[model samples]
Target: MSEATTHQIPGLKQKKVFKIIVLGDSGVGKTCLTYRFCEGQFLDKSEATIGVDFRERNIKIGHEDIKLQLWDTAGQERFRKSMVQHYYRNVHAVVIVYDVTKPETFHSIASWMQEVESHGLMRAPRVLVGNKCDCGTPESRLATTYAQRLADKYGMPLFETSALLDSECDNVESIFMTLAHKLYSKQPLRVVSVEGELGPGVVTLGRQKRSASSNDSCLCS
Candidate 1:
């Protein structure tokens, strides 16, 4: 990482901005994962995302202030095209999530990665996340060994986490914080970019909701 001079968004003081797109099959808890990270609480219920939902949070990593913009994409096939065309631009990282209890959803990880690579984003910092660990029975859950093998196939790290547990918030925090630090460490500072309204085919059900603040220690190495 270069200690080079950084630029800023017009009204913001963040030293860097990282765009992370969250992808997974429907009902895999993609929205809840982001809600937990941004709000520090589990979201009890949420509507299925139509095309995409945008959420953001500001955090201080060491002495540097950074903003993380998360794009939660809809999992349904019909909506995937517009999302791929519009939201995949300028993404710094990718989080491909799956439900621990549903093996079909887990199986869909290959397709999600194919979508990412289809957009020529094969080299972006990507991680595999198995969500909803708290709601599954041992007999019903997919083995972590399998998830690890798949992650290994892609040469990315795998993290198994639960969005519904307050006790597991640190695990949730570590997922994104790890990505932020990785992106910040390896990339050069670029001007903060903003997203315009999704025009034409895309459905934008949720506006961007900003997190309150970030006054905490780095949870990942």
Candidate 2:
């Protein structure tokens, strides 16, 4: 891990921080995916996150220094209701994960998305992930087409990845880095805009413009 430099270069922009929450059912590998990206190592075993856990990583992209605060939330029904508000509060992005081998987990994505919508995080950059791909066989895994269809329905990109595999672990990093870049580029700070001559100004933020390849950009390649 590289230490953040204390010395500041003249004219250089200060580091930007973003908060990202990972949501999924227990055993869907949310914690493992986060550990791989932030720690660069696969977690062979982990207990269910109690309510929430946080991890931070410093990265640079195109001359921009970024700090990612990844919040790994507990996926159990018991823990969810108590912490849902806190999890969605001030979140810059959302990552919805599902186990490729288990179709039920994939089905639960809709409910999870509904949770995001209920908390008014619909405008936050969100992505869908099918995890543990390496553990599934052709007979057991859900088709990529179905996953893509869900992603298309939600207007978000879909990535199929295995955090436990050395070869595919880089995809895990790509997933978060892609979101970091998107949030950094959007600069979602509060801004006041005048709508009419005799009306009060409106404050707007969190709106995003979709790119040509945004819906299909899978960094797994």
Candidate 3:
């Protein structure tokens, strides 16, 4: 079956909001992944993403519902000002992607890590993604190794994906869902209760006993 036919599966629904940011160097295919996952569509011929592009898709994990707000940012160095402006806030998870065919792109992981930290979003769950994995050759294995090291450094998950071939696509949504579940579970719970008055409320009863004891001591003096 053709790629077009596969994406036409019916009745896909949108659930909860999960804000995910895609970060990588220029020409690494961040926009393509966002379009493929959210719109289920692909364009072989396209321009680089400008400042930002938005896409949304509903994903389900067991009994939980998730809506992914995928953000595709421009990866060019000249666009740093615009990129930093949108960095950090409201981001639940991040997917730091790099091109497997371009080793330099893989090396830029350190810079990307710095960007994440500078935005004060280092605590957010992150996934290191090696895009164009179908192009992986003996030469490209080196890039993969570097990608793994970055994943280890950040204690983040790693995925080698091909937006064109749909490789690793199934696992992508689950990664976001897992992050969402972890974030939700870490939230503190608050409880409130009401009680009926006793012979006296605890505060009033304690105060009366203290006053009586003081009065007896004063009489003795």
Query: How much lDDT does each candidate structure score?
Result: 0.82, 0.81, 0.69
lDDT of 3 by residue, 1-221 (tens): 12322242234233436677889999988987777777665547868887888888776645656677888888988877655565456686788888889988888988998988877668777888787777767674556566677789889887877777754566554555566665444321100000113233433534575687898888666
- Which candidate has the highest TM-score of all? 1
lDDT by residue (tens digit), candidate 1, 1-221? 13323433245444578899999999999999999999999899887888889999999877878899999988888898764578888898999999999999999998998899998778778989999888868878999999999999999999999999988899999999989988876664232112223232111211221111222343442
Name the 10 consecutive residues with the lowest summed lDDT in model 2: 190-199
Ranking by TM-score: 1, 2, 3
Runs in model 2 lying further than 4 Å from the true structure: 1-13, 188-221
Range of the 10 consecutive residues with the lowest summed lDDT in candidate 3 = 187-196
List pairs with backbone clashes in candidate 3. 16-67
In Å, residue 2's CA in model 2 sits off its true spot by 28
lDDT of 2 by residue, 92-126 (tens): 89999999999999999999999999887787889
Clashes of each: 0, 0, 1
Clashing pairs in model 2, backbone N/Cα/C closer than 3 A: none
Better of 1 and 3 by TM-score: 1
